[model samples]
Target: MGELIAVYLTVHTPRYCTYETAFAGKLAHPDFRAVRDGLVEQGRQLAGVQPDAIVINSCHLVATFPTVVDGTPRHRGILTAQEAPELIHGVEYDFPGDYELASAIIDRGRAAGHVCTLAADVHYPLDYGTVMPLVCYLDRTQRIPVVPVSVTLANDLEECFTWGQYVVRAVRERRRRAAFVASGSVSHKLVRGPERWPSPEDQELDHRFARMLADGEYEKLWAWLPEYAETVEAEMGGRHLAMMLGAILESGRRFAAALHAYGPSSGSGNYVISLS
Candidate 1:
């Protein structure tokens, strides 16, 4: 059986690509640069694992009815983010897709009584939440193939977690070494200004959540998720984290969790963490 080699939680801000210097300048205050650098280091570690494919759960691609997997054999597009064109305009990307593994995930999810489908649209462009980390962490040549999974907003936390369990089973049944990435921020309560930070209460919540993750307290995290998501205004309704937790739990293995870095961006708490 194939094993999950590593799991990562990473931030997906265009600022990492568009405003590196400005982001780094605030290192003394919030250490944004350190977080970015730490993610790069984590990426390097992932590369060393030599995974055949990386299954990514992206918060940006929210599906309504069934969970969607990007199964295109090849992906190439120019991304101009609708949410923030100024930050991520005309960004071109080309990456190989893992059709075989993606198809297996869809079948496995359906067998498990979850709504899942494969997306083979050649014109489909990836959102920044999926692209930014790929750009920063993976090699430019894109040696490893990717299986991009979408988050379902209509699915509650439990459903999302069940979908993740299906993903884990699919990867293992295929007998392929894989790495899983959860790309999103936490405590996302947008305010008027881009430079503003989250409230002190939100910051504390972020820290506690991070601590729970580091301590491998999945039960506690799940128990507190409903209230915590509402209180902190979690990004993507906390589906990304829910999916990651599900995958970790389904693996039936204990991981040494590490909090690589954490910082704030536009009132959101961005964190870089690794589980291995």
Candidate 2:
């Protein structure tokens, strides 16, 4: 059976890509630069583990079904994020895709009553939420293959968790070393300006949620997630986080969770964390 080597939660703000220029003036802000730098280090550490594949659930890849797995054997793209083209435009990326593993995920998810399907078209492009983290975390060559999964807007948090369980099973049955990544932010209630921060109430909610993850209070976090997502407008409806948690907890393995850094992006709380 394949082993899940690690799990990570990362932010996908285009600002992360242009921190040196777009955010250069705001570099002095607490946790802004630190979070970015910490994610780089964490990416290096993940690369050192030499995983066979990295299964990523990107908030940007939204689906109406319960799940969708990218089964394309090869991925090549030049991404210019629509949300903030000025920050991340004309970025080229080419990487190997784990079609075998992705297919397994789809089969297993379907068997588990999820609406899972393979997206095999070469025309399918990688979203910024997927590419941004790969750019920050992987080597310039991107030696490891990736299996990108989409977050379903129609699914509730519990359904996302169930899909995650199926994903864990698919990975283990394939018998490859893999890592799971959740790419999104928290308290994603947008304000008028890009530099704005979320309200104090929303910030506090993010703080508490981060603490729960760091403390390994998975049960509590899972219990509170539904209400919290509705109240704080969590990114991708917190489906990405729910899936990450389900994969980790359902694996029946113990992981040490750490909060690497937390920052603000357009009034949203962006947190970087590692579960090893």
> Which structure among the candidates has the greatest TM-score?
2
List model 2 lDDT by residue over 74-151, tens digit each.
888889888888778888888889998899888987776777779887889889899878865644467788899999
TM value for model 2? 0.92
Off by over 4 Å in 2: 19-31
All candidates: TM-score: 0.91, 0.92
What tens digits encode model 1's per-residue C-alpha lDDT throughout 1-276?
Answer: 787877889888665544342233333334467666777767777776678888898889878978999889988888888788977778678888888888888998778787778998889778878876786565445767888899897799888888777778888988878888999888999766545678898989998998988888887887888889888888888988888888888887777877888777778888888887
For model 1, state the Cα shift of residue 32 in Å. 2.6
Cα-based lDDT at residue 89, candidate 2: 85
Mark the regions of model 1 whose C-alpha exceeds 4 Å error after superposition: 19-31
Report the Cα RMSD per candidate.
Answer: 2.4, 2.3
